[model samples]
Target: MEVKSSPYYYSLALLFILNLIGTDSLWASPYFQSGDSIESRREVIEFDESLIEAYQADEAYNYFKNVREESAWEKFKHWLSLQWNRFLEWLLSGISEGNFWNYMALVLKILLILGLGLLIAWLFNKYYVVSQKSPPADQSELNLSEDERLIQQKDLSTLIEEAESEGNYRLASRYLFLNILKHLKDYNFIEYQFQKTNTDYKSEITQQDIRSDFSYASRFYEFVWYGDFKLGVTDFKAAKMRFENLIRNIHNSKTHG
Candidate 1:
């Protein structure tokens, strides 16, 4: 083959063009170049080592480290304190908001407390004072109304007439009982005394029939008088018959004895 057309000559021509272009110049191009070292360009920061420890020891910084977990009771107390604070806030908010209901509720609570105090004071005065005072031994010295206190001292017939006239059957029953006691005293069956109870006089009677009659009279009189029973004319008549029969029986016994 001719030298101009030979493949060896073409290869040599291509190598010669590559040598002129140069490796250094091709690598130095912007596309192939690298940036400056990252370490060399880095900013240098300097700080005191002691400052790290100082910051760690600070109360604000070390708060979580020093804190201990709360016990159940302490946790409950904390929760309760928070609830109380919230309640106080709510209560005050009502007033601050000018709520009429909240003001009325406060007033109602005050009135209720005052009412409770008054009730307790009244009970104490009524029950305590009554319990502390000793009852008088004598019937004449009893804590009674003026009329009741002088009942036994008055004439039986007059008292009975007055009680019946006034429609005070209870007072009439009391007069009847006093008359029975007076008859018992006159017959020497019993000694009447202002200090003595009806039971005391009943115990003195040796005769069974008289004692039974006296018992019935006493219970009837007590029911009408001390029991504070109000009686109509019909009821008074029925009760009066019992006392009259007892008085007649007592007279019959005294006459025979």
Candidate 2:
């Protein structure tokens, strides 16, 4: 029997076709949605049954499940995707009644607020909280007697001379540079700022030019201390000149002003 179709009947048929497509998209077994939590043991059992049916119908699961040596990162990503799918499902279900553009706008606003909050937190931690800590206790106390200071200077000079005599040029350079830094700290020319207990001394020298000079000296000291490359006689001579110049500058700055 042939039936004539009205416009209402045609529209109804179109809606039914679209609904079938949507159901098929939602029910597809291969691509799991992000953030899908296992809500119940019953849900898990149902999922296993569905998986068994899918394996029987399609041959892909057998091959994938047989892969034994998956990396830790791969497993983590898989679990993360599953959780994401569960979250997405909850979010979509709640927002389904709203207009699509309104939901999208809400999501963007939430993201913007979250980003701004994180940025503010990071700035506060970096500039305000971290900067307020005191310098090392030993560095703050400048109560050394003149004789003690002279003895320290003498010990440092002897160490430098011994290293040079032994032809351990690298050690000699490092000893000389570190001695200068120690002297600077003792004289209150620079404050020892502790990042950790082990690595103390951040330069709080006020003058930019002096800070730059100290940084250059420190870099060269580190290079000689840690690097395997040999320094030539000319390089040693240059280092000595720079060291003497630095001492003179510090003394001059103290006396003239």
Candidate 3:
């Protein structure tokens, strides 16, 4: 005959059965059902292993890059330290050897270099790139003999008349300017220096009205002569009028004075 089990044993057995069932469910894969075969599980395990390997490779590469950067920085620091030590040693040795005069000479050489640089900069500013386009104060006439100078000092009025007769209005306008300057020179209103710019003469003319007339004539001369503008008969007439005005003003000032 079969023996009957105790109630406590029977309850314990039921609980163990339920716990096993719950644990099986808890341990099941979320991607695949618990019922999947071993082959499917093997493929998923291989995929996880490949992912881990790839992650390990990326970590190794990053570690290698960090090591290389740190090594480069250390090398640069070492080189700089070596250079600094060499410089300190050289400086100390030179000082200890009583070569003070040599050091002084070096300092003097540096100062000379600095002075040269400053002089070059000054030359660039003064000559290469003039701030104001005014001509140099030393530029006037070319050197010539006294006899040649006498021959060249023909009267401006006669030159103008000859130029007009030749139908060279451009040349005549130039002579008209020279005549005004000659009159100015004779009256001692302004020094007729070859190096003197028109602005210089303008400054010398203390009279406002006279300076105004000179400015007009000087501007006309600069434009037609230096500007490369083709001077026609009409331009010549205007230039002559301005020159005449300048001459008359100079004469009037002289007479009044």
Which structure among the candidates has the greatest lDDT?
1
Per-residue lDDT for 143-243 in model 2, tens only? 22332353356587787787777777766676667666765666676654333211233345655555666776766765554443377667876886787
**Cα deviation of 182 in candidate 1 (Å)?**
0.6
Off by over 4 Å in 2: 1-153, 193-202, 255-257
Q: Which portions of model 1 show Cα errors greater than 4 Å?
A: 1-154, 255-257
Which 10-residue window of candidate 2 scores lowest in summed lDDT?
Answer: 135-144
**How much is 17 displaced in model 3, in angstroms?**
64
lDDT of each: 0.73, 0.63, 0.68
How would you encode candidate 3's per-residue C-alpha lDDT over 10-59 as one tens digit per residue?
Answer: 99999999999988887784755666777765743236788777887885
Residue 222 deviation, candidate 2, in Å? 0.9
How well does candidate 1 match the true structure, expressed as C-alpha RMSD? 16.0
Q: List the residue pairs that clash in candidate 1.
A: none
TM-scores, all candidates, are 0.40, 0.37, 0.40
